[model samples]
Target chain A: MASEVKFEKVDFYYGAFKAIDSLQLTILARKVSAFIGPSGCGKSTVLRMVNRTNELVAERTRLEGRVLIADENIYDGVDLFSLRKKVGMVFQRPNPFPKTVYENIAWAPRIHGVKRTDELDEIVEKSLKRAALWDQVKNKLKSSALSLSGGQQQRLCIARSIAVNPEVLLMDEPTSALDPRATARIEDLVEELKADYTIVIVTHSMQQAARISDSTAFFLSEGAGRPGRLIEFGETERVFTNPSSRLTEKYITGRFG
Target chain B: MTRARVFDLSAKAVAWAVAISTMVFLILIIGYVVIRGVPSIASVGLEFFTTAPRGIKMQGGVYPMIVSSIYLTVLSLVIAFPIGLGAAIYLAEYAGRGRFVELIRFSADLLSGVPSIVFGLFGLAFFVYFLKMGYSVLAGALTVFLMVLPTLVRTSEQAIKAVPRSYREASLALGASKWQTIRRVVLPSAAPGILTGVILAMGRAFGETAAVLFTAGSVPQTPASPLDGGRTLTVHLFYLATQGQIEDSFRVAAVLLFVVLGFNLTAGWMMARFRRRFG
Candidate 1:
């Protein structure tokens, strides 16, 4: 449902120190884009700027340039709440609400005024199925979401995001906390979800980016106390196999982060 | 082997001694109160609660004082809950690292640390003399409201903050407005902790004597309205004890203890229920 997203000469700072510097990138519609970088290289910060979640940070922080969704500037006087609904996010750690499984899925729809119980039930089931979690939790919909295993909780978080029918789904290392099997399942789900929605994932795993992403961006910390900078961006195959920059080759070949 | 056995035995003995002593101290206080207060209850029987105070005689009841105490507690809670909760929400959710938040938090801490007698003086100077409210139930309720407001604000703020950050993010991602997220997700999750604070505030308001005495004027007769003067159960006990009506004072003290005990037990039960529901 999400159209292409474009970041044009965007710069971000926290106090005197910059976190992201003059970054330019485009995330094609209905494709999975992955940002791979070393620790503290502003990958997550870049991901957060897409939906304006970074605005929740202290007011002293600054942003420049623009992030556009479907050719409309998301940063220009748009109502942030509506922008967030269109651009949903899932964190690295699965943080489920302290509520029942059914209520977790139903929360978004209910907030948006989907008061009909039957419609809510359908949305919950379909979203769970899409997130690949319906079978494991169908019988225990009323159980507390915290009771789910780590992998299931992450999927439930995905279901929670999908239930709102967002156009874009942003993930910040969504599989980092998961085990191999769970991570594989989530990768499969992401591949399936790309048919319908635009997804931008920030991952530390180069293999994960190669496997699940259509495009990949590499970032590196410039120097001590300096903001991280974007190094290279291209198709996933080209970036991993035949990158335009030596830093991308060094990172993919396991020389260094 | 002998040294190890001796050390283990001494450690176990010390642990048992500490645990038993703590329990014994608690039991001793309860035992003393019951032993001294039971006889007074037996002397007056049900009249200790059912009949009106009869001029320093043990033959009368604590009906007016009991009713007045309940009235004041309810009124204070009604006034404090909304204001305290609103201030808490503003501090925890909206005021993020601002000067106004720091100022409010500092003032609330200062208010909590102020002694009850100081609050009584403020009530007297502000509500009684300045406002010309003059020794009424309204003055008593207002004084108790001030005494409990800081507790409610601090506790509710902690409770609201304890809600997970993910809940807010998930709610907002669903297109819910900021206030809607607070109402639907944050408040419901924090309800138990907020209720616990309210109950504690009620216990303090019910037992207060110094603040109420200065503002409420300790009228022994039943209050006809909020504007009328009244004496709460603690005030009645203070008067009888000071007036040297030892038997009557003991009766009133026993009744007050019973009421406090009943409230505490109910609050404990409610807390357990909330924990089971949400925790």
Candidate 2:
């Protein structure tokens, strides 16, 4: 089943440099929400916050406020291992494990206590098919995933995420490293996957946001040294066509980042 | 030629000269050891590895010393590997840019820089006398354990750190626990580096004379227990050479050098094979 993620007045900092400040956003259940911003605008930081990935940052960094999934505050006494299982993430680059294609998808299931070989095989096949990668990798499931093409590897990463049966899939510019052909394939896959999982993606590509996302949140840097802030959030079609803020307009029309 | 071309050619010449000189120095050292040690090898034949050391004027083999050296090296590695590797994992995976990490790193560096003789003195005082263990294999093993710990920690940390962050992120994104990510992805990639550190530590332990001399004592016999006295090949060689038994000293030196060389070569081959398997 799908789950809702809510971020309330969340602020992140690396020492004195605040990364995200007083941010509030509610991601709809089973919908694709795209966060579009220029580089270093804290888009990726926000994406990582949902899964508590920022905990991996050194202790010198600080996080405030609450990130909730399914009405539970994830940052409070929550087991990070279980939280990560429910809310999966994908990076900007295609980083499949240095394992076989089948093993890559089966790793999480195995670690989470799925020991039956037939059951794991079924999960791997189904997840790969869901990611639209099963056909291409079916014959070479035993080969190293690093041997896959960039697009194939990204899909493989997606399949790996889905095999864990995560309710929320957070992708940080997942298609930014892919070619147009691969990007289109991922775009199509995202649309199909939104029916079963809540998807949040951070992207620099406005066209990609317009093409695939259900809702769009535009963020912009406040000043030279200041961290980025949310400028606008609404339906993708309305945000792109009739943006309420000038900065959002400028960004959509390619005037300024 | 242009000025830039002239400068480039001069830089290339200097680089080549430095590289060749380094290689030549290594070759010279190795050649000298082989040439000076060959006569003793011919005299002792295979008995050097198969017989026990006898008194100064008599002819005998250094088999007891060889066995002692192997035992000490293996025991030290067994002790050092877990502690060193655990320290490395803590530094590389858990500890971040904080005062504690800096403190750990600084202490490891300081330990590495301390002379081997100081470790010997400390081992003699603490393990041999103060602790009242006496000159025994246990004391020598403990001395070597302290001697190689910093090297293993630093090298293993470097190897673990060298693994691409992308690998960790990928594994984490796939619903793996932090420990699982480290155990499955980071450790395997870092294994070759950790292994290299272990091999280097083994080499140091095998050839160590100063530390073992004070703590283990030069008892030319097989150790019946860790508490019993023993002498490694390097210590035996030093005793023979200093005692003016030229022929016996040469023979022991040759055997020790050959053993060290064989170990180094085996480690090198294992490293190469590991790279081929994992690369």
Candidate 3:
């Protein structure tokens, strides 16, 4: 169910300000690619582009060049709804809908035209099981999602997104707002999920990137109000231990960022 | 006592005095109306509510006026709700923040600020005369719709905007279209606030007098259809008070107050229920 993501000569702008500049990369299928960088390095911006969710920002924005998924150029002719159906997202914060746990998981599938009650029930159960939230929530599917703790709420959001069966899952600092235990749980979930879904995560935690990701991409900007560039990209082990770029080595050594 | 403590005590006393006096004044006004109205209704019994006027329009009941008021209020709300909600949704969700959106918002604010008498004149010239609907419930309802539209749209817009943007993002990320996101998530979350606006607008429509008087006429009869001219309760009461039919006017005032109070209470109850579910 997973697909490779390719970016070629990509340039992104918010209004007239260049955000990400002249980037080219390939994210392989069924692997977790972690984008580790300091704040405002345009990592989240790159993650959002896969689903074209960046267009939801109120300001004027433009994306130049091609982003391909499964060998299809998504920007050329793909339907926005279907593109988003194939690429789901989880945010920095837990944002479950103000609905029942069952309804939250069932919502996306219902929108994608899964109408039968029995089918919805199955999806809810399966998605919750996949997200490791079934045992805690199965007894109270009718209860509001807000009743769940912050960590459980984040998992619920994951379950809700995956219920529609997307090929790729984009996480924008999904564990940043969580506690250590919650963050660890999400990391483990990612490891399990990468077997089926192509996962891309943006994180401030370098250790998390080293611990879970297969390949890691490091992005950096020269200063404030400047465009972000990909500093380095390679297997996580080599990137952390024997990085090719001096800046990546300096950052990984905790000397400067 | 210390100067700071003295100032704090005086401020507390002033706030308490203001709050108590406002409550006292409201109760006094309502009590006065009830005293004058209830005894008269008690004397007349069921005939006061069921029968039509007799003997120079002061002898029997206000059944026709009550019927007209309900008809005009219901019709106006039915007409205004969808249009106002649509405009509100466009402003809050779809419309880009720009000069045009600001101009639209300014126009709505200006419309709500215009006096009721001016609205009455416009209703007379537009709905009653130009449109050739005559003095009827349809004309009155149309006039009331125009009068209450700004309030409905403004309140609904605030409610819709209050829904967290994250909810929209979460819905859209799952591949729901903009319309699907709005219907399933945005609208349901905004329902309680929108309902409050509608009920408040309903009270405004029901209590409206000058506009309805101009468009609906002062015919003392139950309307057979929306096209039929009729007298609303406020118009009947105005006529009664000016004609020295003090007893009937007080009774009409009492009924009007109770209905508006009922609307406010219902809004409160519904808001509590929605909050419980949504939270």
Candidate 4:
């Protein structure tokens, strides 16, 4: 079910203020790719483009290139529901709905036309198990999703996205707000999930990118108000050890953002 | 004491006095009304509520007026709730920051600020005269609906806007369509706040007199249909007080106070239940 996501020389603007400049990158199917950069580096923007979620935040946005998933141009004539169904997202914060844990997982499937109670139950259980939240919340499915701890809530969010049986998962700093143990658990979950789903993660921590990702794409905005550009993209091990660009090496070695 | 300390103490005394005076004024008004009305209510017994007015509306119950008030409130709500909620959702979620939306919002604000008497005049000219609905419950309800719509729309818009943006993002990313996200997540979260606005509008509709007076006639008979002319409790209260039936008017006032209080309490209880379920 996994699908590769490709950004072909994309230029994005938030109402005339350029955000991403001439960015070209391909995220392989069934692999974990990490985007590591500073706060305003547009890594999150690039990730959002894969599912067209950036349109929700800024109304006057303008895009200058194609975002393709599984060889289909998502920006041209694709249905947002189908596009988002194929490529799910987990936000930086754990944003579970103000509903029961069971409802949170069942919601997407229900919207997607899965109505039978037994089928919804099976999907909910399988999703929670996959997200590693089944054990703790198995007896409390009826409880509000907001009652869970932060990490648990994030995992529930992951469960909710996967319940729709998506192919690609876009995670925007999914673990930035989590504690070390919760972050490690998510890292472990990501490692396991990569066997089936294509995952793109944006992270601020260099160590986190080094720890779990198969490939690394480093992004940087050279100066203030300048559009962010992709500086380097390669195998994680090679990029960290022997980068081609001096700027990439400097950023990897903690010289500057 | 230091000068600063003295200043602080004086400020505290003044603030406390102002707060206490406000509380005292509220209690005094309620207490005086209840005391004045209770004797009249007690003398009338249950018949005061069950029987229609008779003998020039001096001896019989205010039953028809009570029924008319309820009918007006319910009909106005039925007519206005959907339109107001739809407008609110559009203004908050779909509409862009354009001139049309701005004009709509400004018109709503301006309408809400207009006096109820003005609304009564409009109702008389439009629904009563032009529409030819006559001085009936339908005309009164249409007037009340227009008067209440602006307030309802503004409050519901604020409530919908206040829902956390993250919830919308989460729903959209999970493959739900925009309408689906709004129905399942956004509206539910905003339900309690919207209910507050509804209840406030209900109270206003129930207690309204000036607007209903011109639209709904001062007929004492029970309205058999929305097209039948009737008088609400507030309009009936006005008729009684103006025509030297002071005791009957007091009884009507007491009933109005209690019914409005009942609506508020019920709404508060429902809001608490909704919060507990959602949170």
Candidate 5:
């Protein structure tokens, strides 16, 4: 599989404090890759860097080295608007705008200049169906997105993301705030989505990484006052059953993360 | 009773006494004004609202002042809203975190704190003399614009900042430009707050006397255009009282007080409605 996203010795800093150092990784196209680590291990940072979402972090945060999406370096004069259009993000919390469900999905397309009502209606329905939420919310398309339950809201966020029709979807602990049923539904959706879209997920759940990811990358915090590095990367089964690094082995076996 | 209990009882009594005194004083002033003002209002009756002030002879009417006050307020707000809102959006959403932003915020605060009389002088010097607007309603509207800009910018900035960060991130992630995000999401979310600030500013513009005294001269007849001299309620009231037309002055005071009261009630009702819908 061709590499869809690449990080080349990327060093990220929050003011004087370095969070990610000398990180090298490749996410394959149309596959689910999971980044798992203990807290503050820079897994989420790595995920956000793909689309330059970290640019919105506190003013002091600075990212050095190259982050490439497909073949182009995202940092080197890339049009941020188009780059974001091609790469969508689902945050930890399901942040639906204070708008109707239909508006939540249609807003992205509208801003991108999709004006015809019928066309927007079609896109909204299709996106919701793909996210497996159409059946539940088909009748209440005009209702406020906040009125949905936590699980449904998460799904609605996914639908909103897909509505923009991005090639890559970044999920930052998307199911962490969801119940088991909602989590399972999202996992199923992820499995279905990877056939066409490159999906990079940051998950804390070891089993979730094991069950859903095609490949897994293990990250470990280098004590205090040091940045996190990619310790090991390999096929999910191999990493779980027979890891290469001692830290990876220790992490999977739950010895001392 | 114990010492602690006695102390607590005394504290409660003091608080009650303070609160009641405030209410009592407020009622006393309004009661005296209402008692003195009503007979003049009744005697003048409909003519109070229908005819222009009869100056020097002190005929009883404030029709010109009422029209002038309304024009100044509406025109000033119309001109000030966009400029103030734009500055606020820059401070809240676009400006980087640095001393530059700090300087701008500090400047706005300082301007707001400056006495309105100083602003009147500024209007007199800059607009009336330099710009040669020449003591017209336009000059007065411009003066009030400066007077109200700080409040508008500060409150609108707060409103914009209060919009959750997630909305901005979500909008940006969806390929919307920063300008687009602000126009579509941030502005709509901050609408109620902006409107409330505007209403309060309108009230301030209506009640202002010093700022308009030089810029908007107290013309006897009603103003016909922005270039014409106009007198607001406060200016007319000042003229009436200072010239010893106490009864006419009371009628003007009653009118000013009720108009300000209406503005406050409308603002309060709007904010309450906004909170219920958004919260």
Candidate 6:
């Protein structure tokens, strides 16, 4: 597998305090890579670093080091508009605009310069079908996106992102707000989606990382008032069953975070 | 009865009594005006609504005054809405958490608290004389726009602040620019709220007496231009009362009351509809 995203000697800080300290990792394309850790472990920080979603932290934040996507540094005066369009994101909560389902699906395409009516309709259909939501929502495309259930809204959000045909999809706790049934459905969807796009997920559930991800990176904060750093990274089977580091072994065996 | 139960009942009784008395006072004022107005209105017939005022003769009706009131209210809104809403968006979204923003907010609050009579004096000095609008509808509209601007800014800022933060984040993450996010998401979600502020400002502008008395002259004619001097209902009623024309004052007061009541009803219905759809 080729490396699609590489974080080289990255140090992320929020104001005067550091959040991510000296992290290094290479995520491969067309694979599900899970970053699993306890709360405040900077796993979510790592996930946000990819698409620069952390830019809205509303505090004085600074990043040192390179976050390269396909061997290109994403932070060095990159065209953020096109970069964001190419790398879509699904938030923890399903926040659809105060618009109809069809508008929600069509909005991304329209803004990204798709102006033809027939082309937009076709993209909306294909995107929704890929997100596994076309059948359930086809009849009610005119309904408000907010009217759907939580799970359906999340899927719609996914479809909305994929409408832009992004090269990567970033999900931040995509199932934490969902019930088990919805969670299971999303897990299945991820398994199928990994065939075409690079999927990066931030999850606190160890079982979740074990079940779906092909590669896993374990992270931990050393102690009080310390920034989190990566502890281990390898194929999922070895990371869970035969971690080389004592810290990764103890965490996987439920010793402590 | 237990002491606690007795005290609760008495408290409820006091609250109900206070509320009912306020309602009664309102009703008495409206009722007195309507009753006193009937004799003069019946004597005048449809001429009250159709004919222009006869000025000092006071024999015709107040049609010109009604037209002036409508024009003044609409013009003030046209001048104030865009500027006030823009200021509000800046305060809510772009303003820094610093002493500068604090200074702006403090100024807006202080402006709202200044008396309408003070606004009248300023209008008399600045708009009527200095700007050379010369006691015209434009002068009155510009003065009232300044007078009600603080209300629009404060209320619109509150409405914009009420939108959820998640909406902003979601829009930005979708590759939409900051302006696009605000235009599509923030403003739409804040529309009903800002509209409430607008309606409240309109009510205040429509009934304003002192500001218009100073700036919007007492000319009783059908104004053909914004530059032409005009007389609003409140000014007409004030003139009649001061001149001891009790019956004419009563009729004008009744008309003003009904117009205000109509505005309140529309505002209530609009707010209820907004709640039903967006809640």
Q: After superposition, how far is residue B248 of candidate 1 from its true place, in Å?
A: 4.1
**What lDDT is reached at residue A8 by model 4?**
94
Which of the two, 3 or 5, has more DockQ? 3
Model 4: lDDT equals 0.93
lDDT of 5 by residue, B1-279 (tens): 999999999999999999999999999988888888877799888898988766466586778888899999988999999999999999998898899999999999999999999999999999999999998999999999999999999999999999999889988988899899999889988988898899999999999999899899988668889999988999988988898988878988888888888998998898887665444
Residues B73-176, model 4: lDDT tens digits: 99999999999999999999999899999999999999999999999999999999999999999999999999999999999999999999999999988778
- Per-model i-RMS: 2.0, 2.1, 0.8, 1.0, 1.7, 1.5
Ten residues in sequence with the least summed lDDT for candidate 5 chain B: B270-279
How high a TM-score does candidate 3 get?
Answer: 0.95
The per-residue C-alpha lDDT of model 6 at residue A75 equals 86
Taking the tens digit of each residue's C-alpha lDDT, what string does model 3 give over A138-161? 999999999898899999999998
Q: List-wise, what DockQ does each model earn?
A: 0.47, 0.47, 0.79, 0.79, 0.53, 0.57
RMSD of 4: 1.8
Candidate 5 TM-score on chain B: 0.93
> Compared with the true structure, what per-residue lDDT tens digits does model 6 show for residues A82-155?
77887888888888877788888898788778999999889989988999999999998888888888899899
What lDDT is reached at residue B234 by model 3? 95
The lowest-lDDT stretch of 10 consecutive residues in candidate 4 chain A is: A248-257
Candidate 2 wrong stretches, greater than 4 Å: A7-25, A58-68, A71-77, A100-102, A135-143, A225-227, B1-8, B36-43, B96-101, B172-177, B245-247
- As for model 5, its CA RMSD to the true structure in angstroms is 3.1
Q: Flag the better candidate by lDDT, 1 or 3.
A: 3
Tens-digit per-residue lDDT, A185-232, candidate 4: 999999999988999999988899999999999999978799999999
Worst 10 residues of 4 chain B by lDDT: B52-61
lDDT of each: 0.88, 0.87, 0.93, 0.93, 0.90, 0.88
Which wins on TM-score, candidate 2 or candidate 6?
Answer: 6
